[model samples]
Target: MELSQEEILARLAAISQGTAVEAMKITITEAFKDRVVATMPIEDQHRQIVGYLHGGVSVLLAETVASVASVLNIDIDRQLAFGLEINANHVRPKKDGVVRAIATPLHLGRTTHVWDIKIVDEQERLICVSRCTVAVVEKPAS
Candidate 1:
């Protein structure tokens, strides 16, 4: 059976417990079969030595959204998705407040999925653009 939107979001949240997603305070705001959105506040921990948002954090957020979206597309009972590769371009610097990541599928094949992710600040200015490839594999029996 297909899960409801709320149920999918709850499952995503549950899987994120005690992970970097939780530590970074990333919240999955909107989730759909084809798209996913998340937001993270820029706190001290998210900043680099010069106090700008860390580029790695942007990449992390990008991969997180894309991977979660991939999981939603596959059969969780039989398939597992893992990020295979990712690339990002940082366009703007952010110091504080929240940034949102929106992810959409570029390619969804039986073995792999590619996602385009955009990170924007509160003003809707582009902060980072990323593409992530997720590998889908059969789940090993427990």
Candidate 2:
């Protein structure tokens, strides 16, 4: 079931309180699916010595979205998803413009799920692409 925004916030609130763990925050500014568009505009700090966006950040955005999508089907306590593998390909680099990534569901299996992420920029240039695989784990008894 899709969680209400309030419920999502409340659940994430617990993660933020330190009793739980959540790696990424689904901010209100983020969009999803077709409406999903994100831009991490390049800054001097983000740039490499050659003046290109750090390649690591590009992969981070892709995996972050994939992990977020994987959590949609997960339970609070019993079962959680964790990354098993991630493969990223850097097609090109941009030093001045914004960088964005979009994740699409590649497969959702009983025990595994995969997502194909495509990263682009404000000018609609391909930056990086990645595939993330997550494994579903059944937690031990409390």
lDDT (Cα, tens digit) per residue for candidate 2, span 1-142: 7666567556544654532123322232243432233446676766678888777767666766676667765664788788888989989878776677777778888788788888887777788989989787888787
Candidate 1 C-alpha lDDT tens digits along 26-116 = 9999999698999999999999999999999999999999999998899988999999999999999999999999999999999999999
TM-score of 1: 0.97
Compared with the true structure, all predictions reach lDDT values of 0.96, 0.67
Give candidate 1's total backbone clashes. 0
**Displacement of the residue 79 alpha carbon in candidate 2, Å:** 1.4
lDDT for predicted candidate 1 compared with the true structure: 0.96
Give me the displacement of residue 62 in model 2, in angstroms: 1.1
Choose the strongest candidate by TM-score.
1
Error of 1 at 25 (Å): 0.4
